[model samples]
Target: MALASIPTKQYIEQREEGYWIKGSRVSLDSVVYSFLEGETPEVIAQNFPLLSLEQVYGAITFYLANREFVNTYLQNGEAEFGQLQKDCQQRSPQLYQLLMAGQARLSQAS
Candidate 1:
């Protein structure tokens, strides 16, 4: 018997660094985050208005199929993001302070 195959749809593409949706700048992590945040596929699509329902489902399916790998990738990506953010802060301490203050205000409002 032959192994099952995925359908030919331009939903997600895997790169050495990460997975992203095809024809859009949105990352697969963004979709997975929305799903994990208790959002349904429809809600995810709504939150990322640029994405369609089908694209969101495809990204979710890919993540579910490769949960462990995607999780590790996400963790590494977050680490890299933190490093870059730190670099940016060092480059512009005043901007970082302003951003932190704005975030604090937003948090208080919420």
Candidate 2:
């Protein structure tokens, strides 16, 4: 007898950007990161109350099943986020410079 194939339904959803859990805006990365940080599934669910424990387990299963691909996708996403932050800072240089100046002042006061 053949084992049943995995169905992504009720567990994961593919968006334009990437995979997110069904019925919640939480990304699979949040789950994976928390898991990597040694957080339990229950704690992950608490960290993202919108996700149930079962969903957390399911996401972990998916990640385990496709660890390499998922890791690459996570890396690419981090790179993209870094680029976006660079673009935003470039677009609003003055705001960030002023914010940096305030932070420097606070650090000196401490």
Candidate 3:
């Protein structure tokens, strides 16, 4: 089947990554990114309570169908995250301190 033949309502285009998938209302990129970050499907589902197992699978299908685009997105995200970390360290020392403190707390909790 053609790409256009895919049902629109069943999917949504991720704004940051610009990819489409079923369940337009859901943030598939966020889900996929969480998975890439070593999060389990159950954890992801907990984060997105409205998402079903089938919908999560559909997001994976969408990612597989557009591997290059998703890979680029992941690459760009790392670059952007690095830039943001640098900027935050330079431009917002107090915020950086607060973030570090939060991270420390999280680590201790874990």
Q: What is the C-alpha lDDT of each candidate?
A: 0.90, 0.91, 0.74
Tell me the tens digit of each residue's lDDT in model 1 across 1-110. Answer: 99899778868897766788987889898999988888999989988989999999989998899899989989999999999889989999999999999999999999
Worst 10 residues of 2 by lDDT: 6-15
Candidate ranking (lDDT, best to worst): 2, 1, 3
Candidate 3 Cα deviation (angstroms), residue 18: 5.0
- Which residue pairs clash in candidate 2? none
Q: For candidate 3, report its TM-score.
A: 0.69
Better of 2 and 3 by TM-score: 2
Arrange candidates by TM-score, descending: 1, 2, 3
TM-score of each: 0.82, 0.77, 0.69
Best by lDDT: 2
Q: Which lDDT tens digits does candidate 3 get at residues 12-87?
A: 4656555544445666668788778888777777878888766676677777787897788778878999999999
> Per-prediction count of colliding residue pairs?
0, 0, 6
Candidate 2: residue 28 lDDT (0-100): 93
On lDDT, the stronger of 2 and 3 is 2
Q: Which residue pairs in candidate 1 collide?
A: none
